[model samples]
Target: MAPTRTGSKRLLHDLNQSIVFNLIMEHQAISRIKLARKSGLPASTITKIVGNLLAAGLVLEVSADESSGGRRPVLLSINASAGYVVGVRLREATITLTICDLQCNSTYTRECSYQPGTAPQQVITIMATAIRDLVAEAGLTMQQIFGVGIGLSGLIDSARGLCRVSTILGWQNVELGPALERQLKIPVRVDNDVNTLSIAEHLFGQGREADNFLLVTIGRGIGMGIVLGGAIYRGSFGGAGEFGHMTVDVRPDAPLCNCGKRGCLEALASDYGIVRTALGTDPGHAIEDAIVNLIARAHAGESEIVAIFRQAGITMGIAIANLINIFEPSHILIAGEGLRAGDLFLEPMRQTIPRHTFDARDDIELLICPTSDDLWARGAASLILHEIFQSPIYEDEEALALDDLVSQASKAQKHHKK
Candidate 1:
């Protein structure tokens, strides 16, 4: 009973601190008074939380600037150099590793490949080795790594850090988070790759302002990440973002999807499907001139090549129109490697979306951003960063551990300096 009470007290304190911390992060150079006002916490509570953050070396006090008051207030900002984080993205055979600072600026990246059907344990071992090598290459100790965040395709149970199923990886119920944690000796978080990208966008991209939006990624897969009411909406069983699996084409002769389902949107609009069709290649055969070449042909006005992209764009547009009608999101962000086709691929989607949507509003904005492996890897890193700065009300045991890592990292930095 005593221990339980103590734990509860600690949690409340941590929650309060998190509230204050987030206020400081968002405001960047906010005064204690401004923090109190923004966080709705009492002035004394704000003072205590700020003091703790300063003492922890997680935040810094900047000199006061001009203010229309008797005494100007000092500003607070996060210590970007307080620690480091590792972000990893796992494709079917290739793994990308990224090391970023607390601010999520990627400083180092590594690419590694494995046999396509590598066992889960073998894949985890590959990740552990690459991370260790990259950390050493970056001239940082393991202690400096706050944690590792991993993003992979398919049905990821983020809360449990389990890969419920990844058609791309040929895995099922793999305890990826725990398996990586054992080797890395730090906290680990796993999420759907698209969801991770959405997290990064929410924190730093177009999603900073838009609360209700959908992130539709198209590449090896066509998936969507949903954000509603300023929160990521992972539906029951944590499979909410499987937008690519939607039955867009129901015909028996429609292309087969990797999910063992026929006529999935992924089958018709995904990179493999479109490229396979354009090149007249059998499934699983690498086309001589791949998607890039096909895109070039489309750009050159090759009628047949252009037709394939137009059809794919129409299919994707219809799917998005369905998304718009159902969710009525204020913004739709389209990203992923498929954008390489340029207007040849997207112009049709842009043109087709409005036609299918019911009462589509002029105010809804569509955002398209370039994608890269580095960006995706950074998105993975933001998974750890998200937990660190996440609102305490929504936090669970993981938040407590993340906070502990922050304190530990700060102390490690100070010890190294000493």
Candidate 2:
């Protein structure tokens, strides 16, 4: 018993030590000098930390780069195979799951279809099973997994792990984090899918260097994620970027929105809106056929279709301009499936945005980019990695350890009572 207790204590201590060392491996590639500078710990403390990290195989010395005044200094980086995380994205009709290592390299990815009318519990079970299978296929044990992050389309209260509403999935008041944590026995983070995707782009994609930008996604629905001051703005109630719901048409006779509002931007400019307008002209028209017809009409200079797209573009531009007038982001990224008609929409949006923007800030950059379906799932995984690295663990090791100890004790007490 004494030996067992000693071993347990050593294991816990080593685990806590590894957490800090892993953070350095992920964030920086430098010698002890820069490591101490970045981590704000003394040289001796950094030496001890790196020594333990090296012994545990969590970090590796890549190469030595020479300083101007002295010999080359060895740089440290995360051992990519040290551990892995699972990211799951649940959409209206599909589920995407991915497994990634400490360095954010994806090991495997899988996609499964969900019934349109599936319940939240059913979706949760499917997601959990998919994650377990993917981790097992990767030959990793449960202890090797860092955590799980889930991204869903909806009004998500990320801080509280509650999804207040998911219009796409027809869900509301779902306790997503607690449910997943209970099943997976790992830390779980649930966030708005667009916000997650924006973070992923900010860290790993085109927005990596941009401190301020707006990520607008137009698809079955429309949404935007505001990145201000290098952090996602979740608003007062965690529903900050509902740009889609902004009213674009004040006419009472305009189309009704999914949220039961009339003439919303989503009802005017989304893919569904475009298709609906096209089909209204010819009742037997398929959506794809309508897209082709609309494109042809725009190309042939048909006034009606052109006017419809132009009106939608103007509304979209107004919304974007309003956001810019308030936040002054350096760039706005337009992405999603709806961008298939980029040529038709870009001109009108570009024209209208400048017209409405204050101070002639039409100089703000606007970029139209294409995104794949898996991007959101990858973003979810990035969220877990971000939290793991940027949390208080890297700053005050003792405080992090104490917090973990208290959490573990509380869980144990609840289990004993059960």
Candidate 3:
């Protein structure tokens, strides 16, 4: 009974601490009075919890605000330099890794190219080494690092840190989280690259204030991330937003996709597909070269190149319109490396979406944006940060005792089963 009562009290305390810390981080420079109002916690509890965080160097107090007169209230904010996390993005041809501080500021970044048929073990080794070097360069020890968050191209089971399938990498059932953890001896989080990008955009980019939005990324492959009620919607099996593979043409004559399907949106409009059509070859030079050439030709007002872009844009718009009809997100953010040619894609997409969509003028808005490679890594880091902020942090022995009790109960259950 004593142990149970102690555990209950500890759980309650940890929950309150997490809530207070999250409220401060979300509303930077918030006053204690306002934090109490927002968190529905007593002012005394908020004061005590904040003091503990400040002592741990996890939060800082900036200058006070004098808007309400009297003594200016001190404003609390997260300490951006409290710790660091590493973000790694594993793409088909390149692996990008970034070291970011608590505020999601990149302190260092490294890029490495992988051979076309690189094995998963080889790739993981290189990734681990890159992460180690980045942390060493930052003069931080392993313990100072929070964890590593990886964004990989595939159907990622983010909850388990597993890659369900990646046609590009020829990978399936890859235990990415456990593998990284084993090599690095640190906590790890993994998610689909596009989903991670959506999280990044929602937190820091175009979707920041949007309660509901759709982020469509066009590049090596097309994918989307849906944010509903200000949160990412990962459906059952963590495959909700694979919009790229959604069927657009059911005709048997349609082009085959890398996924062994015909008439998929990715089969027609992905970077590889576009380049294959433009160059008139199945196996040709790098798609990047073709894109550069296309951009130059479009800039030179070459009608053929412009027409191809226009057609692709219209197809993309039609796909988006379909998404709108179903989900009806408030804002649709078009991003990815391919957005460099947004000027060529925008007009056709704008023209076609309206033709296909049935909506009032103010229902949804579309915005085209470009993102840097670092943004992908930052998105990965945001994944870890979300988990950390939501996790209960115990500041006293009572919480530790409660955790021990829970562990013991689990062990006893296992023993009984045997």
Best by TM-score: 1
Model 2 stretches astray by more than 4 angstroms:
1-28, 37-40, 67-71, 281-306, 391-418
The Cα RMSD of model 2 versus the native structure comes to 7.8
Identify the candidate with maximal lDDT.
1
Model 3's alpha-carbon lDDT is 0.78
TM-score of every candidate: 0.93, 0.82, 0.88
Off by over 4 Å in 1: 1-8, 69-71, 283-289, 401-403
Candidate models: Cα lDDT each: 0.85, 0.74, 0.78
lDDT of 1 by residue, 122-223 (tens): 999999999999999998888888889999998988888999998878899999999999988898999999999998999888898888999999987888
Residue 210 C-alpha lDDT in model 1: 88
**Reference-based lDDT, residue 242, model 3:** 90
**Model 1 lowest lDDT segment of ten:** 1-10
lDDT of 2 by residue, 356-388 (tens): 789869568888878766667778887777664
Which wins on lDDT, candidate 1 or candidate 3? Answer: 1
Instruction: Write down the RMSD of all candidates, one decimal each.
Output: 3.1, 7.8, 7.4
Backbone clashes in model 2, listed as residue pairs: none
Instruction: Specify the poorest-scoring 10-residue window by lDDT in model 3.
Output: 396-405
